[model samples]
Target: MKVCELERSLFESFPKVDAESWDHVGLSVGDPDSTVGRVLVALDATADMVRRAHDGGANVLLAHHPVYIAAPDAFVPRSGSHPQAAAAVFEAARLGVS
Candidate 1:
């Protein structure tokens, strides 16, 4: 299945509206057009989780917690802080984690 298709399926069941108004839900990275044969579900979208998904041959990483709280531009590379968020984005981009 494609990433977009999986997203649709998930939304059909979970329904993004069920999340709190302040919650950040749904796809956090990668491209929806990409093909996804396997999926890894977790509570957080951390760097290690991203790596695990890639190593496990999964193309999508679905999480309950928000991966990125601030804007993508706010996460400066190697800024000491926001390391996890930055790494998450980098790994997702490099490995195509959606």
Candidate 2:
């Protein structure tokens, strides 16, 4: 399945409207058209998780927690309050993992 297709399926089952108003619940990185070779579901999107996904040949990391609650002013890896999230987002994009 493609990233966008998986996203659609997920949202269909757990509608985005059901989430808290302030919750960030959607794809935070990667191209929607990218094909999903494998999926690694995890509790969070950390830099380590991104590496593991790449090592395990999973182009898609279906993490439960969103990378950020709100969009960052800039994506400066390891230089923010949420360093892990910043690193994960940067790494995911660099490694071409969705």
For model 1, residues 19-92, the per-residue Cα lDDT tens digits are 88877777778888888878899899987898899899888888888887664554334356655788787788
- Superposed model 1: Cα runs more than 4 Å off: 72-79
lDDT per residue, candidate 2, 1-98, as tens digits? 78999999999999999999998898889999988899999999888898899999999999888877877666656664755677888889988888
RMSD of each: 1.9, 1.6
Positional deviation of 23 in candidate 1, in angstroms? Answer: 1.3
Top TM-score: which candidate number? Answer: 2
lDDT of 1 at 69: 63
* Cα-lDDT of candidate 1: 0.80
**Model 1: pairs clashing at backbone N, Cα or C within 3 Å:** none
Clashes of each: 0, 0
Clashing pairs in 2: none
TM-scores, all models, native as reference: 0.84, 0.90
